[model samples]
Target: MTQLETAMAILMKVFDTYAAGEGKPDTLTKGEAKTLLEKELPGLLKAAKNQEEVDKMLKGLDFNGDSEVDFSEFVVLVAALTCACHNRCVKK
Candidate 1:
């Protein structure tokens, strides 16, 4: 597979792995989302300054107000982060 294809597969795998933790098998509950962020995106959590900031970030990821994050919402989070990282890299 191409690099982008591999990345997409990895994203789906990561979401599936975490979303399977509890509740629905497709969407991420709050707890599952927290675990996924803490484990998979520890740097993001660390950069959050405080619990409130982290909470806000999570809330923002729940685009549909469903109290859970579906795959499309998760992709938005990843894409935003990727853009942020890319911009930082370009600056350097």
Candidate 2:
């Protein structure tokens, strides 16, 4: 597979792995989201400065107000982070 294809596959796998933990298998509950962020993006969580900030981030990610994150929402989070990192690197 191409690099982008591999990345997409990895994203799906990661979401599936975490989403399978509890609740519906297709979406992430708050607890599952927290675990996924804590384990998968520890650096991002650490940079948040406080638990409230992290909570706010999670709330923002739930764009549909469904109290859970579906795959599309998760992709937005990943894409936003990727953009932020890319911008930072480009500025240097």
Query: Could you say which candidate leads in TM-score?
Result: 2
Q: Which ten residues in a row have the lowest lDDT in candidate 2?
A: 83-92
Q: How high is the lDDT of residue 18 in model 1? A: 99
After superposition on all C-alphas, the RMSD of every candidate to the true structure, in Å, is 1.1, 1.0
List candidate 2 segments past 4 Å from native: none
Best by lDDT: 2
Clashes in candidate 1: how many?
0
Clashes of each: 0, 0
- The TM-score of predicted model 2 comes to 0.96
Please provide TM-scores, in order, for all candidate models, with all chains considered together: 0.95, 0.96
Q: After superposition, how far is residue 3 of candidate 2 from its true place, in Å?
A: 0.9
* TM-score, predicted candidate 1 vs. hidden true structure: 0.95
